[model samples]
Target chain A: MLQSIIPLAVDALANAALIFFVAVGLTLVFSVLRILNVAHGSFYSIGAYVAASVGLWIVGAGLPDWLTFPALLLSAAFVAALFGPIVEKTLVSWTYGKSEAVQVLVTFGLFLILEDLQRIVFGIQSVYQDTPMTMLGISEIGGIVYLNYQLLLIGLAGVVLVALRLFITRSRTGRLLAAVVADREVSEALGIDTQRMFMIAFTLGVFLAAIGGAMATPTTGVAPGLGADTMVLAFAVAAIGGLGQVEGAAIASIIVATAKVLAIYFAPSLDAVAPYLVMLAVLLVKPYGLFGSGSTRKI
Target chain B: MAHRTSIKTLLAATALVTSASVAVAQDKPASLDVGVFTFMSGPAAAYGMPGRQGAEVVIDMINAAGGIDGVPISATFVDEGQGAEGVISEYRRLAEEPETDFMIAALSSGNCLALAPIADQMEMPTVGWNCDSHQLFADAEHPYFFRPNGNTIAEFMAYVIYFLDNNPDVERVAIINPDYSFGHDAAEIVKASLAAFKPEVEIVAELFPKLGSSTYQTEVSRLSAARPDVIFSNLWGGDLENFVRQAAPRGLFRQSQAVFALGESSMNNVDMPEGVIVGVLGDGWWRSPDAAELGAPEFAEAYQTKFEKAPVFPAMKMANAFMVMKAGYEKAIEANGGAWPTDEQLTAAMEGMTIDTLTGSMTFRADNDGIVDQVVGMVGSVEGIEGPVLTNMVRYDGDAVLPPEGEDPMAWIASLTPDFIAAMPKPGSYE
Candidate 1:
């Protein structure tokens, strides 16, 4: 059991790293914007497409191989920079203070449009740019050969978790965002430039989602329908963690990934439904989530 | 007294039916409008687009040759990436069109199963180009629906025989297939075949990932940790490419005798290490010796010129489907005194017919299932070719592996003995 559990745990953490990037960003957006961005996964895939294209171009142009690492970050920033303001100012802003049904319907429509746009831009064939993944090579853990890149994702997720916490608690803009999350009406009353706050928070969410996609490109193929798959999993993780709870999202990602990895390992038939089953059990026991509160919401 | 129709009324009904049959046998459209259904988008498109291109090029060639009885063939491509409901709707829409004469119904086995009953109901002539699931015709029969590309039973059973022969010392095996009927059915066939041939072997792990899953790291870890002597998967299109890309770097291929059932399609698109076992499901290899003698090399070169990549098995399967369609049309035309053949006549032409293809010949049995050779091999680099191609190929005669007509396929597999495998052709024996 110990031998088996060690590998399962490593697999779970590796899986969780990818899921956490999108789930945390989703919960973060819901925390401040009070809107569930259904199209959030589109940003993730767009970032992936941009990263794959840029990485391929860099390699093709005979640039240094190490540059692919920074290119991943730059690709995420590029996606957020290009799409963040345009989509928020136009489509997502309309859903502000609206009913959840309206928000979902509108964002679902946006999701479809963006999915088509990706096809038009990237075409239907899958794109692969694994310079970053192949560069790091492989490592043995728990008697299993693993990609060092997979371990890097785990470490990056941890760094992002700590850095995000620090940003929210210590940074001025993060404090303003936190204040808004605590009491939106009061923050607006205190002349917080609520409109600017919405843009900044939304853009940051996009950045997180995009980076998640960008980092994933070295391991996975960037293709159509990726956004929809990622979005569904992210939604499950956020719900299992309790919506709008960042740390809750983080823990829930691990739980969900573990459920999936365990299913793949033993109950192979249940791989697809494992995350949902975990969500069902977690929600049944705690209406809020592992780290979420019933009465209070936190950023 | 039983409530029965009057003699006059019965005579009238019989006459009307006779007239309808006669009209179907005699009438032929000036042109054949075929509905070619395959994937044109999404992950499956990696396989589907090649098939679609094959259909296009083959039809263009036929048209350039003045078509059957001077009727140029035209095609309307319906994307099978849409679910079965949409595929059925598209098939029905095309069938309803007076100009549409026949259909190369689908690349997906799921869609093929759904459309089979509808074809029989509508009396439409349909051919399944790449429908590979053994379950398609296990319990169901369709007169107007036929598959020229063969089924999963022959395909996966061949792999089991080939693997057991090459690696007699293998103890444990693992399978990670896509989560679909195609994947699950292959697993069942492989396991059943193994149990009959080598009862001592143990299956250590089995996983069915969701189709089009973008990542396989966890599955890879589980497979590696299982420490199986053999690892087998039937994942195709982008999903297969993705798995090979991720798994190769971790030395999973080096650790186990990795077998990709549909690896031929991605040989050009991705870089696979030498010595991995790959197959094209059917004997549709684009570079086989038989293919070179049969002019398949020229077609492949032409395909590369047009599509920027060499033709894969899916392309060959699609090209073979077109050949079968043309042969059926010509046979029907000849039988009907050089006139156009209706759906019934076309279906009659397809029944119990044997047609030669680019790779090999196929014989359609009474049940509308075709018997074609199954090719399996290890990947190796040729001196002049730019990429890896199949080496150490063994072509198993189709009839030897397929369950006899009307027999329960699984039960027939269970009844086989080790002597049965010993008597069959061994690897590299065909060459």
Candidate 2:
């Protein structure tokens, strides 16, 4: 019995780690920006493409294997720095103070353009770079061998949660960002350069999404349509976690991942719809989500 | 002004007359237009692109060699990765065009099933290029539709018989397939084959994950936990690549002898570990003993020079379909006394015909299903070959594995026994 359940747990954690990155980014952007940012998933795929390309380049150049690890993080940062402020200022800023439908339509258009751009640049073939995964080696868990990189992913997700908490609570820039999130109109009235806050918050969201994509490349094959799949799942996690709640996103990621894992292990037919089923169930019980409140904003 | 006006009017009238004459010429012309469907994107593209490439080369070769009795052949390629609805819409649109003569459609079985009824409705001569589903023609046969390749029963039966013969002591078995009709049908056939040949063997686990899914981490873990002696799967294209990539790292191959039925299609692109059983669905291995002996090496070299990749099964399937088309055109022309034949004559020519392909021969049975040999083998990294190639091969006679004309396939398999397999060719004996 333990043998059976041990693999299930490991699978759930690995699944949860990937979900946490995208969900956290979506939740983070919604918390500060008050916009859903429907194109957030494009950032994730771009990160994956960049990471795969960079990792492949490093290996091709005969660079040391250890550099591949840092290359993953560097690729994500590069995508964020390049696409974050540009998209946030030009396309995303136009959707501000608009209706929800307008925001969705605009960002959705951006998503379509980005998807086409990815195809043009990377072509239609799948890109895989597993240097980091190979370097991590494998471990036996309950008679089943697993990539040690998978375990490291679970640990890294936890560290991100803690580090984000510390940064938001302790740092000066983090406090200003929080101040902007708390009351943007008042903060702007009080001479807080709210434009910089929006730029920083949006860039951070892109970085988070990109990091998720980069980290996942070692285990999964990066292909077309990945952006759309990631976007839908991230939306489900955000909705189940009350949209803009950070801790709620973390907990909701596990719930969604667990539901999908259970469906795969037991009812294989329902694997595709399992996460959405949980989302529907959670929304039915709590209309405002588990952590959401009526008037006050909290993370 | 009067001279210019008269000149413009004459030019317009002349243009209208020429356009009308051109339209009439095309209406009475004898050429055939076919819509060849295959995947051209994603990991499946790795396999599907070869089919498209083969079609291009074959059409060019056929046209140059006097195309179908001097009526030039034309093809419109459609990508099947756009889902079923788009494929059906494209089929309808193409069928509506007056110039379209036939359809060499569909690399996917799901798309084939979706387009079958539409073919009947449109009354288009549609040929399934690589469907391989036994159920497509099981219920009702469309007069206009045909498959000149072996079905799932013939393909999967070959795998089971080969494995059972190779490992007579095998006991436990497991299955992992794409969660669709193709996957489920293959599992059923494997189960039926095992029951007929080795009833004592236990099926420990059966898994079916969604098609085109990017990850197989959980499924791999499940297979590892099951600890079966042999694992059979029909997951092809991107799903197959992803499975191999993930499962190899986890030592899934070390635990059990894996059987990937459509494995040969990915030999060039993926680094499949040695000793895993893989096969081209039919006798489509470009490097097979028959192919090597019959001048397939020069053709393969030409293909590699043209496409920068070796020809996989889909390429061979497409090339064979072109050969079938060529045979039809040649037969029609011969019957018409050396003149371009009409659509009816071409269709008549294709009925009840056999043609020699690059690898082997394909005979269109009475029901329009093709009887072609089933080739199964294992991945062997041979010297001088740039990538892995299928070795230890056994080519099962197409007629031996196929069900009798108008008989139920499942019932046919149920009536078989171990003695039946003993009568068939042994593993690695094809040479």
Task: Write candidate 2's Cα lDDT for A130-248 as tens digits.
Answer: 89999999999988899999899999999998988888889988888888889999989989988888888899999999999999898777877888888999999888888778889
Candidate 2, pairs of clashing residues: none
The sequence of per-residue lDDT tens digits that candidate 1 reaches over residues B351-395 is 999988889989999999999999999889878988788988898
TM-score of 1: 0.96
TM-score to true structure, per model: 0.96, 0.93
Which residues of candidate 1, in runs, are more than 4 Å off? A1-3, B1-30
TM-score (0 to 1) of chain B for each candidate: 0.94, 0.91
Error of 2 at B392 (Å): 1.0
lDDT (0 to 1) per candidate? 0.90, 0.86
Question: Least accurate stretch of 10 residues (summed lDDT) in model 2 chain B?
Answer: B20-29
RMSD of each: 3.4, 6.2
- Tell me the tens digit of each residue's lDDT in model 1 across A1-299: 77677888889999999999999999999899989999999999999999999999999999999999999999999899898888889999999888999999998999999999999999998998999999998888878888999999999999999999999999999999999988899999999987888898899999999999999999888989899899999999999999888788889999999999989988999999999999889889987777777677789
